[model samples]
Target chain A: MAEKVTISTVAQHAQVSRQTVSNVLNSPDVVREDTRRRVLDAIEALGYRTNRAARQMRTGRSQLIAVRIEPTRDGINGSVLDRFLHGLTDAAATAGYRVMLYTAAGPADEIATYDDLLSSYELDAFVLTGTDHGDVRTEWLAARGVQFVTFGRPWDNPERHLWVDVDGASGTAHATDHLIAAGHRRIGFIGWPAGSGVGDDRRAGWARAMRDAGLEPAAALDRQTPDGIAQGESVAGDLLRGDAPPTALVCASDSLALGALQAVRAAGATVAVTGFDDTPVARAVGLTSVSQPLAEAAAGCMDLLASALDGDHAALGHRIGPMLLQPTLVVRQSA
Target chain B: MAEKVTISTVAQHAQVSRQTVSNVLNSPDVVREDTRRRVLDAIEALGYRTNRAARQMRTGRSQLIAVRIEPTRDGINGSVLDRFLHGLTDAAATAGYRVMLYTAAGPADEIATYDDLLSSYELDAFVLTGTDHGDVRTEWLAARGVQFVTFGRPWDNPERHLWVDVDGASGTAHATDHLIAAGHRRIGFIGWPAGSGVGDDRRAGWARAMRDAGLEPAAALDRQTPDGIAQGESVAGDLLRGDAPPTALVCASDSLALGALQAVRAAGATVAVTGFDDTPVARAVGLTSVSQPLAEAAAGCMDLLASALDGDHAALGHRIGPMLLQPTLVVRQSA
Candidate 1:
């Protein structure tokens, strides 16, 4: 076995004091650039690794961010979170943080998991996803003064904490406007049942776009079901077979849009369809959809969390507003 | 904020010594069942979290498993890793471990990341994915005597380390056998370019199955291109347009099958197409695909890792053989 490399080895190799080596690894800014580069080179040559546990015990910062790995729901839409996580991991690495993943049954279970993580790991902060109205996870973290940021907006108290969200309403509105421009007068919407903040926001965008274009978004043309391709197909089949069937459909998700496309094909009807999230399935099937700037959102979340961890409470308070990124409308054959 | 709870607080509340509380949390087997229960109840009441950094400093076990989060490649097949990650997180929790994620450009970069993770975090073990011919990641970890397991087989040195792999050859063979049983004498294969262990394994299955059935596995009917829907479409289209084209196509991945499905539709050809991975896209499009038991594989990996960490070197040596899990062929309308 190879000899174990330690800080003393690195210091000896670099001809520096132990404190200088420690400073280079922990607080590089405090060391001279030449000295720091020499120490780093020696450490790299010796393959010296800092003991993070000891550092955490001293500094109370693990340089780890906790996030829940949600179960794969309807497989089609599940890729959205997967992509976001990829983006988050990349962004976190750039910010000198690693992502730690956990699985929980629901919000209550998630809160419990957070408690366990905080008690055991002393994680630097958390980057949460799937935020919704009456979210207990955010409240628990905020009450305990845990530094955190969410990928979704806090619907009830947007200003309470840092959050980065894509404008779903804007995304759906763009899809609707595109269809309206393409000579679709009677357009239908397929979405989840109301009460979800995200769902309501998406439906509102479709409604607003219709009203702006002086088209009636009649309740008859709007269909609601839990997000699924089969459900999308079933609901869309009924709408296509109904009186004054829609000339196009704006779906809340790629899963629903794929289903709607199937229904359109099954009905042998030419109905334009647009889906949200611009999932790969949508791309594979040539469906026009709305795309979120997931990488940007991830970077934004990291930036906000960095500020929160910087301990600049006054500046953080002033920067408490939500960061909403616009979604792009990806034009494809379906629309 | 409420008063901070410590080991001492739990000890006082449970009417036990601090060492007893520590034993209950770390080594429950050393404490009586009734005493462990009392300590746990007190912990629940006070919300006491173990200082993991201190514990790690004392025991050298962070109970963290590191895994690389690969970039989202060709969106259609990316869900496979996502599902695997979900499964791994769930299974790791059950095994009293947490999953930490990192990203790297390629094998060398991943090795560097591993060094960083090991030096700083002291991760208990790594769960690697995307193993292939001459995989340096596995070699580096093995050389260091790191406790780790891979979600892929080491193609070159199969018996060198611990791994859990889905039998890709068997999966494609089943798909081929299904087509042959349905009286499809001419079966075409669409896969990635040669040299990839996984792709080659999948192709080998089809060839073996064809020869076993006394059918000619002709080179003219086999095509290789990068894995993508468009690539699959282009390759499958050429095969379909060729002289005496196959009545069925077996693809290495769902993405390719999806493309082949498009080519079949475009050619107006009555062809059966099967995909591997049984990704959500395949399910949504009703493509027959091979499904790897991801959760079971995850559990298998965790079980092996737990054994490796249990310090039972003799038993672990006997259990060092690779765990090859069977893939289930999920039949749908595509085939």
Candidate 2:
């Protein structure tokens, strides 16, 4: 068997101290360019792989980022999270990191898993998703100084942590504008029951677009319901039956838009329906929807996380802050 | 920080050899019960953890299983693979194992990922799915003596390794019988294009049941297409347009059956339809389908894998040849 390469070997080969070698690898900019070049040359010559395990023993860092994913049995499958997860995995791999996936029962179980993984030195940081008001996961991790970043915006803590979120309001605004450009006056909004940060942002975008178009948003046309195709279909049916029916419906999710399309067809009514998240079903049925740049946002997240893992607290909070990428609208036959 | 407990420390505390200590933890039955108890007591007393990294240095094992999953963009989300993956993950966790997920572009890329993961010592064993005739992966792994257990049955080399598969033949047989019981004289069959082992098995089951019932299978009523709802709907529509239309339709998957239902509704026909997999979509639409015992199959895969990882190769192929669990019929409003 070949002798395993270690940092000590690299340091000796480079004629440098162990901490100098560590600095060259983790904080290259801190090291002199000439010293860093020597370390890099030695690393290349010795085929010294970055031993994440031994590095964890020395620096208390694991080159592993954990994402808590729940395997849901809901009717809506392969939603935005799946795409984001793929993008995150790709970005992490490119950054010489690996992703560890684990499922937990709820917030409490999730926190316990995080604790266990962190204490065992199995993970260096965590990636959070589905942030809500008073998110316990973020609060617990922040108190412990656990390096983490969220895929969604930090609803409660804006300055304490790092996050990458899509501009949902802008996405819905474009969707609403598209419908209005198609000569629709009665624009309706279908979204989740309102306290959700993402949902509300999307609804506000539609309202803003309506007001800009000199149209008063009617309460009779606007409806909020649990996210699902059936619920969307039923609510859309009810809204269409109302005295002032909407000629165009803007849904917060593709699942809801799917239901609205079915309702419109069932009622033999023609209406432009726009959905968020250009999901597979939306593409199949040709539903106009907003598509988030998940890969770019994921790349942003990895960049922020890499800075956090390197102990760049200032870069995370003050310099970079939260990244918000714009989502583009995909026009299809349904709209 | 307190001194980290290692295997050598545990061996010294237990008054046993390092090999014996390893056997006690990995394959307890190989060691005497009294010696195992002593090692367990020492492990508890010293709070010893079997460091997977250090163990790999000695035993060349990573204690991690790799499962290649494709993040498909198909409309049929939460397909059978997702359920099987969840079951596998849960079963692996229960057995003190971790699962590593990786994505690949295609079969060639998947094989390359397996090779890379194995060479890096990042994965101890692999779990294969979607096996086909002359599967390059099984051939490659078998030639290298790499430890692996397939979730799908091996079409080529049955005696080389371990596998667990649900009995598709029996599942379709029961579905066919259910249709017959419902007094459907002429039942149509909708399935994927031929040459697939699973698809062929299911088609055979329907034929067997029809033959057993003293009914000749009608060739004209049988249709084969790619697995999709739209294709299923279109093909079923074609089959119904034939001179002798079937009173009921038996689809190979829920996606196909969903399309069949839509076609039936459009035609205002009362043809009972049955789909397989019984996924969330099937349950939502009340489509009667076949449900594979995924949890049991997953448990079997893990058990076989555990035995293989423990150096008990005899337990895999001889004692427990490829496990074929029976799938049951899930009756819903459609059938």
lDDT of 2 by residue, B1-335 (tens): 56546566678899998677777755668999899889888877886545543344346565678776566545354456666666777777556566767767778767656654553334668888878888888888888778788877877666656888888989988999999988887998999899998898888889888999988778886789998888989999998777888999999988889899988988889999999987766765679999998878878888898888887867765647548888999999999
Worst 10 residues of 1 chain A by lDDT: A49-58
lDDT for position B112 in model 2:
59
DockQ score of the complex predicted as candidate 2:
0.12
Q: Residue A27, candidate 1: how far off, in angstroms?
A: 15
Q: Residue-wise lDDT of candidate 2 within A1-335, one digit each (tens)?
A: 46556666678899998677777765678999999899888887987655543344346555678776557545354546666777877787667566766667789777766654553334678888778888999989989778888888887666657888999999999999999999999999999998998888899999999999999877777789998889999999998898878999999988889899989999999989999988756765678999999888878888899877777877766637448889999999988
Candidate 2, residue A277: lDDT: 86
- TM-scores, each model vs. reference: 0.87, 0.74
**What DockQ does each prediction reach against the true complex?**
0.45, 0.12
Candidate 1 residue-wise lDDT, B1-335, digit = tens: 56546666678899998677767765679999999889888877876534442344345688899988989888878888888899999988877789999999878678767766765665899999888888888889888788888898989878878889999999999999999999999999998899999999999999999999999889998999998888999999999989899999999999899999999999999999999998877877789999999988888888889788877677666665547999999999988
User: Which pairs of residues have clashing backbones in candidate 2?
Assistant: none
Q: For model 1, which pairs clash? A: none
Model 1: lDDT of residue B227: 87
List the candidate 1 regions with Cα displacement exceeding 4 Å.
A1-60, A312-322, B1-59, B313-322
